[model samples]
Each structure stands twice: as C-alpha cells, then as structure tokens.
Target: MNRPQDHLAEQDNVRRVDDVTSALEGLVTVLGQEEDLSVVLRRACLQAVQAVPDADLASITLVRDGGHYTATSTGDAANRIDQAQYDAGQGPCLEAARTGTVQRVEVSEVARRWPEFTAAAGAAAVVSYLSAPLFIDTEYQGSLNLYGAGGDGFGALDAALLELYTTAAEAALRGARRYVSARETVGRLRTALTSRAVIDQAKGMLMAMHRVSADQAFDLLVKRSQEQNVKLREVAEWFVADVLNA
Candidate 1:
C-alpha cells in the first residue's frame, strides 16, 4: 500500500510536469509569433523564472563573436548578478556557456569556486545559482541562469527540470533563427530581381535610342555610374526615369 506522503509527492511531481509543459508550449507560441530574437529571449527569461520553483531571478548570457553579455534578465538584481560574473571573467554562467554543460552551485560552494562572483552575488542576497547551456545554431552560444535567494538552494530535481526546459528552448531558438535568416535571404533576392529588371529596361531603352548593341548600351550605363560615383543600379534607374519622362 502507498503511504500518504508518497501520494502527495506523486501529486507534486505531476503538477510540476504540467507546469513545465505549459511553459514550453508558451515559449513555442511566442517564438512563432515574434521574429525578433531579443523579444523571444526576454520572454524566455520570464517563463524560466516562473517555471523553476527555486529561481528568484533569471537571466540569459549570450556569447557572440568573442564577447559575452547578458541578453535579457527578469530584473535589476539578475542583471547585477550576471554583470558580476562578466566582470569577474569566471562564474557558473560563463562556465556553462563555455563547456556546454550545467552548473548548479550552492552559496557555500560559490565562495570557493568563484570568489569574485561570490562577493557581488552575496551583496544581493543571492545564495544559489543554476546555469544551463543554450546553443542556437552556430551564431549564438549562451546559458540560461537562475539565481535563488533561499538558503536551501536548488535540488537535483530542480536542475533536471531546468535542463529539460533549456533543451526545448534551444530548439525553438534554432527555428526562429532559421526563419529570420530565410526571410532576409528572400528580401535580398527580391531586391536584386527588382534592380535587374530596372537595369534591363534601361539597357533596352539605350539600345533603341542610340542604335547601339546590348553590350554597348550596358557600357554606357557603367560609364555614367563610374562618372557620377553612383551605383550601377542607380544609374540605370535614373536613365530609365529620364527616358520615360522624355
């Protein structure tokens, strides 16, 4: 027969699972609607704090090129704590981002592991830290960091839940990044096509007016572009406009 405490524990586990599911679903929905990565990250930070019971504050550390910075945070305390790590040049968040692993540390261990970070975080009354690596395609590597003020700190279960959440968050970030990249490519192609059409029309006009060959007409446009120090497309557009007006 199951004990009463065991049944209560089962209920708590089920509830936590549901909460995590809901948070992940919400993050997916937000990612689908927002093409701006900044907005998506900010929302993710908020959801992370809400989903993790032990997290008092949340922030995201993004590493781009060769530098790392906090991309988003739930509040000033989170930002300050994150800045402490960046200034110290070593902390749980940086370690997680660098190694692509999780870092869960209690207050007692923080002093020994990251003395510089300990002083800053201690000032803010932060006693626990949890960081999970977040990889978004090849452009960004980051970590989702959670700070806890409670002395009890985070448990194994809490770390497991955060890892699960970050895994889902990474997938959503990858999809969003790909979508944004594709949209930009399409836009550039459209612009190129439009420029090509304008240039072709100008070439046809020059060929007719000057009774010149197609190559000669193109040369005339290039000459004007170089003389005016303007783009070939601009010269073509101006020529077309002048001919139409004539």
Candidate 2:
C-alpha cells in the first residue's frame, strides 16, 4: 500500500507539472505578442520564478564577443548576484553557459568553488542557485538562472522543470531573433531601393541637362560626392532636390 506522504508527494508533482505547462503556454503567447527579445526575456524571468520550485529570483546571462552580461533580470538582487559572478569571472551561470549543462547547488556547498559569488549571494539572502544553458546559436549563447532562498535548495525535479522551461524559452528566442533579423534585412532592402530610385532620377536629370551619357552622369555624381565628402546617395539627393526646387 502507498503511504499518505507518498500520495501527497505525487499530488504535488502533478501540480508542479501543471504549473510548468501553463508557464510554457503563457510564454508562447507572450512571444507572439512581443517582438522585442528583451521584453520576452523579462517575461520569461518572471515566469521562471513562478514555475520553478524554491526560486526567489531569476536572470538570463548572455555571452557576446567573449564577454558576458545579465541581459534581463527579475529584480535588483538578481542583477547584483549576476554582477558578482561577472566580477569574479566564475559562477554557476557562466559554467552552465560554457558547459551547456544544468548547474544547481546550494550557496554554502559551493563556497570554495565560487567564493566571491557565494559571498555576494549569501549577503543577498539567496541560498540556492540553478542555471540551464540556453543555446540560441553560435552568436547568442546564454543561460537562464534561478536563485532560491530556501535552505533545502533545488531538487532534481526542480532542475528537470527548469530544463523544460529553458528548452521552450530557447525556441521562442530563436524565432524572435530570426523575425527581427528578417525585418532588418527588409528595411535595408527598402532603403537601398529608395536610394537607387533617387540616384536614378538624379542621373536622368544630369543626362537631360548636361546632354551626358548615363555613365558620365553617374561619374559626375561620384565626383561631387568625393569633393563634398558626402555619400553618393546624399549628393544625388541634394542635386535632385536642387533641380526640383529650381
């Protein structure tokens, strides 16, 4: 026969699983509504605190150009804790990002491993720490971190839940990043097209006014651009504006 405590534990596990599922669904909804990666990450951090057991604070540690920084955090304490790691050049968050694994430990246990980080975290009243690697791509490597004040620290179940959450969060972030990149590429193409049209107009005006060939007209615009220390597009735009206003 099953014990009463075992039954209660099973119930708790079911509730925790439900909470994680709801959090993941909420994240997907937020991702669709928000295009900014920072906003999405902020929401994710807040949700992580709610979804992960024993989590008091959360933050995302991002590594770029061989340097790391806290991209988004739940509160000042989390930021301070993350800064301690950055200053020390070693911490659970950094280790998770570097090793592409989950890191969970009690502050007291890891004192010797990360003295400065543990000191700062202990000062902040954060006892437990959990971090899961977030692999978006080569350009964007990071980890989602959770800080807990509870004495028992995070359990195996907590780490499993966090891994699931980070997996969903990573997919959302990758999609958002791709969307942003595509939007930027489209904006650049549009600007290029507009500049080309303006330059073509300027070339047409020069061809008509100076009776010069298309190549000669383009050469003239280049010469003016060099002389004025301005971009060819700017010179073309100015010449076209001058002729139009005349």
Pick the TM-score winner.
1
Candidate 2 lDDT (Cα, whole model)? Answer: 0.89
Model 2 clash pairs are: none
Question: Which window of 10 residues has the lowest lDDT sum in candidate 1?
Answer: 117-126
lDDT of each: 0.90, 0.89
| Clashing residue pairs for model 1 | none
> Over the stretch 73-121, how does candidate 1's per-residue lDDT look in tens digits?
9999889988988888889999999999999998779889889877765
Each model's Cα RMSD: 1.2, 1.6
- Whole-model alpha-carbon lDDT for candidate 1: 0.90
Candidate 2 residue 48 Cα shift, in angstroms, is 0.9
Q: Report the lDDT tens digits of candidate 2 across residue range 29-107.
A: 9988999878988898888877886798899999998889999998898999999888878899999999999999887
**Top candidate (lDDT):** 1
